[model samples]
Target: MSRYREIKYRTVTSFQRRIGNPILKRLPNQTLLETTGRKSGLPRKTPVGGRRIGNAFWLVSEYGEKSQYVRNIQAHPQVRVRIKGRWHAGTAHPMPQDDARARLKTLPRLNSAAVRAVGTNLLTVRVDLTN
Candidate 1:
């Protein structure tokens, strides 16, 4: 990765982790992706922006595998997602072959735009909802 891109990733993600996530996670309207902590064995909920299509939910991780939630998914593919204040069980899949930039076009606008603007290593993820 370019030095500039690495620096930009750190700067933006730090702010999002410290400020944006804390506030957004509390909003009932905000969609959430819940993953089991890889080591802690606890639930980790992250405010996310994505679209539920049929029985699946799609999203792009701005940081790719580096994102904590992505890492968690790697440890345990079983996950839960909260959309419209209700929760559903799902299996998470990382689709490296998918065009994340193009996939973002099919998701919610504001968050997708932010992800495009700030993302350095975009990666697509699909969660097949079962509940």
Candidate 2:
């Protein structure tokens, strides 16, 4: 990862750790995703902002496609997501172009400053959760 990306990731991780899950619950479009570490096999969790598209929740790789979380999802799709303190187990699947495009149109717009600082893309993936 580039220096900028690394710094951004660390900042976000720190922020989430300091804030805990209540703030995540108030945010209508956020989810806390837990995935097993690829190397250590230890549980790791990260806060992600997501949107509901059709029957699945969708997450965009804001830190670019090369993010570790994205790679982990690809390696092991099985994941656990927490929304409003409710936990749901799921598998993540890459979203198709059409679905991505449609979802992008519906997503809440962010200011240019936020977009530039975060360096997120419009590419999305679906979270197939178990009820």
Candidate 3:
């Protein structure tokens, strides 16, 4: 990674971890991605912005594999997603090969803009909801 991208990554992640995520996760209607912690074996729920189509939910990870939730998905694909106050069981697939920018266009506009603005290594994640 270039020095600029690394700096941006650290800065953005720090803010999100310390401030953004905690607040967002508490909202009743916030969409959440729940992944079992790879090390602690505990459920870790993260607020995310995504859209559900048919039997799948699609989201973009701004930090790609560097995101903790993404890392957890790598360790265990079995997961749950809370969408609009309801939870659904699913399997997560991180798609590094997908066109994340294009995928973002298909998601919520505000979130897609935010992700595109701050994301360094954008990655697409698709959850196949079994519900």
Q: For candidate 3, write residues 45-127 as lDDT tens digits.
A: 99899999999999999999999999999999999999999999999999888999999999999999999999988999999
Alpha carbon lDDT of each predicted model: 0.96, 0.65, 0.96
RMSD values, in order shown: 0.7, 4.5, 0.7
- Single out the weakest 10-residue window by summed lDDT for candidate 2: 111-120
Of 2 and 3, the candidate ranking higher by lDDT: 3
Candidate 1 lDDT tens digits, 31-126 = 999999999999999999999999999999999999999999999999999999999999999999999999999999999999999999999999
Off by over 4 Å in 3: none
Q: What is the TM-score of each candidate against the true structure?
A: 0.97, 0.65, 0.97
lDDT of 2 by residue, 74-93 (tens): 77889888866678888987
lDDT of 3 at 114: 97
In model 1, which residue pairs have backbone atoms overlapping below 3 Å? Answer: none
Model 1: lowest-lDDT 10 consecutive positions: 5-14
TM-score of 1: 0.97
Q: Over all chains combined, what TM-score does candidate 3 have?
A: 0.97
What residue runs in model 2 are displaced by over 4 Å at the alpha carbon? Answer: 1-30, 96-102, 108-117, 120-122
